[model samples]
Target: MNTKFEELEIKLETKQAISDLGLIDLTPIQALAIPKMIDGLDFIAEAQTGTGKTFAFAIPIIEKIKLVKETQSLVLCPTRELAIQVYNEFLKLVKYQKDILVAPIVGGESYERQFTALKKKPHIIIGTPGRIIDHLNRGTIDFSKLTQLTFDEADEMLKMGFKEDLEAILQNAPKERQTTLFSATIPQEIKRIAKEYQNNSSIIKAESETLTATKIIQNYYVVKKEDKMKLLERLLDISNMDSNIIFANTKREVDEITEFLREKKFNANSLHGDMKQKERSYVTSNFRNKQLNILVATDVAARGLDIKNVGLVINYDYPQEDEIYVHRIGRTGRAGSEGLAYTLLTPRTEHKIKQLEKFTKTTINKLEIPSEKIITKALENKLIISLKKEVVANTNTYDKIINEFEQEGISKDALLNALLDKLVPSKKVYEVIEEPKQKKSNLSDFDNKKKDRKDSNRKPSKLKDNAVLVKVNLGRKDKITPLIILDMFGSIYNIRNNNIGDIKHYQTYTVVELSSKGHSFINNKTFKYKGKNIKIEEV
Candidate 1:
């Protein structure tokens, strides 16, 4: 879909590697960074995690790695998990070249094995800051012949308090080598490193100049911390999610949530950094294959492991940092797919939500907790859709079968009722907190209708002038009078009491209008009319 990659003088092997990995195209980050990297330029790339920045550098790094080599490249990552993941990614991308080897040296592994691996004289070294520096000091790893040095998740490394170690690692590397820094943010420390280490470098900013997970509808559910588990259960039952991951702030919470879900008849597994290698692999594989519908994880454990087709990500507890929240939500809505990220927030977390909104540049819509009635309505909607799709779509065949039943003397009402019963499954009501509705105070009943008639008689004056009529499913029965509508948006949407164009209310639905603008505003949201759930959309 993008033609920019074609303009660059890229190696056939590199292009083939991308295609072999089924990455036929480039993400915005890749498109910007790859051309610069191919030019052998030192660069700093600012991006979020899960934005394909990994491959942006890996593709060029692979292209430059000589088949016959001696540790020509060194990649420093924040965590051992990320280091291992980068190494594996390099392995997958460079499948065309059999001579290249990526050795990941990190903690929690026997130093003897890493020492022996270093002895093999690998072409590339991928490691965390502390372990990489340990090897550098012991002379177990060689970087004297290194041509390129990259710091993956530079911001993360600094956040993890690895600045001094990162500096030491960089100091040991050759000054003549090219350096590439990749981070979700460009902080002062990152700039300091770039200034000291890099030459006339290019700056690739993917975050400010790219579309990211546009399909995802992000929302947060504000709940009391004590009621989070009960709310999570209700959410699971209400949302028709096929698969999901629940992230907790601690390993204890991960295990606790996993146990709670399992007890509640959900197939859930917990993964934390404390797990053994085999256990981690088993949990991840089971989750990926849908053998488990839920995975409870800590951020540290789920780092850098790619899982596909996740429909939802629940932030059971909010992350301490805004960057961590970005990474947590990034787990879902990956590879250009729609996902839902629901954060369970307490009253104290209002500031955190504000910060998140500012940092992510996306509004987190607040959703009312699912009540028994709301869940029932949602289920009915699903049933109606399924019946229309599965039963109505096959009406001809069903008609023939029903005719055969009629020959056996089955009554029409009996048959119809039976079909309806079969199509609509029974659901149990659940407990949920109720939100109070605000009542309108100013406009009188007669004045409301008169105001609507006055606006309706007025002429259109705005751009693309056209009068569009929209309807909302709320009425007098739901306590949504014309006065209520006028009061709700009085000054917030620049709507005035006299701007209301019409007023019509049936037992179940209401039709209202405004001078072009107010109609569009109300039609775009899901809101409450009195205590009832009201959905508004274009006709």
Candidate 2:
């Protein structure tokens, strides 16, 4: 445990909560941020994933919080998954403290239940921008009593385009309230936001190692785009992988690839924004427990999720930014354990591959896709390892069987060959051959979360105008089915089923009907398919 934690543990109820969570020491970020946090000075902390930044901010916030029925602390996360993670962490730190409520108000949850919880008057509320905005507009939460605000992953929140909502929420809170922000990098926008709202804030960047995932054997595959899935299947078939994760850029791709893997008999599942909080948690837990072998996910859905024993990470779709690239690889190779990261690249995306190399500063050596011959060899190697293990273990259990075989006039070589034949797979090397494809899908779309469209000049629709023409940069060739697109939007944004009118899957882009709650709700943080960075606008 870091000495810093020992210093603060003596002062608050959070100490017991930390002990319960089995966290005895402060992480590097926690060590530095906690001291400034306890001093009540506004601060911005720059730290990466797995650095315990949540606890760094949460411990101080909970310590300062005067436990009561009324709301006193507010934490805004960029995504529902992240919001829940932060909320749960805070709950652990404040578990033994009586009358302290840590309620999560985020997109994709039941409004009535949240309303009921609010009536009981939570001591703290942690939520995403859209849901918090929803509660603010509905007057479901009383921010007048709010004394502390923390924006976890502030850069990511900005990337999701929550600047307006964040500004509005801070404006509503008391100026004297403590403000804290944590992010992986100190981008210009982060600096700007701090300057605008924070009063004489202290800036602290954790000097700990920035490279978080060193145990992973990072490599890339230079395959034609169409052959990526075939390669994925072949790799899983032969490698001794305990579990795997595939990262995609869009929610639609997550659903499509998950179904494809399932059809091929892989125990696969997908996680993204469209899923309810319960479903997301269930899938994540299953993946972590090894019940699910393959996890297909979007970057947003997988944020702050700590899943151990993930032996491999496949970049089904390359990330747009360097930070995302780092975070994805960081998921594997954790806790001093070795891991493998496979990147499938197409001819067109070769440039992005080089960019990633420069960003990570680690040479991703090119390797051939594992052929049936290579896969068979890998299986043979595994069988050899098992054979060696059997020979070295306590031998009394197997000695009787060997003696019986000896007495039956079985020669040693014949007996050993017979046993090996029974144990190893019968498929010959040639029979296991899988033909590589000429090309594969790119599995990426124009940044939907960053795209934004302007409000149309057309008059508000009448009863028959149920069709809302929202656009996305996915089409037929990209393997985007209607159900997949719907699931994507539903998971990533809070778009309801009935709100969608008609969906026209164009060759290059898709257009769909607007849901019942038109402009006001659609324009909020619930929908990220807008902005100058991405080209999304209403017709």
Best of the candidates, TM-score:
2
Per-prediction TM-score: 0.69, 0.73
How many residue pairs collide in each prediction? 0, 20
Q: In candidate 2, which residue ranges exceed 4 Å CA deviation?
A: 1-4, 9-13, 16-25, 95-99, 274-282, 347-358, 361-363, 387-422, 426-539
Per-residue lDDT over 1-539 for candidate 1, one digit per residue giving the tens place of the 0 to 100 score: 67444455666765676676666567788888887877789999987787788888887887787877588888888777788788888888777777788888987678999989999889888888888888878888888888889989898786656767988988888888989999887876688788888998667887542433666678888776668888888888777677888999778899989888888888889999679867987898888888888989987788776677788889998875677777877777766678788998765453357657877778889888888777777878877887779765674556787788899999778898997887664776555554433344465545443443443332222223454555566654566666666665573465775556555554455556655655547445776645557565554
lDDT of 2: 0.74
Local lDDT at 118 for model 1: 93
Q: What lDDT would each prediction earn against the true structure?
A: 0.75, 0.74
Q: Candidate 1: where are CA atoms >4 Å away?
A: 1-3, 21-25, 107-117, 200-203, 209-211, 276-278, 351-355, 383-426, 432-539
lDDT of 2 by residue, 282-395 (tens): 999998888888999988889978677778888887675667777888878776788788877765555466556765666777777676667787888899998889789945
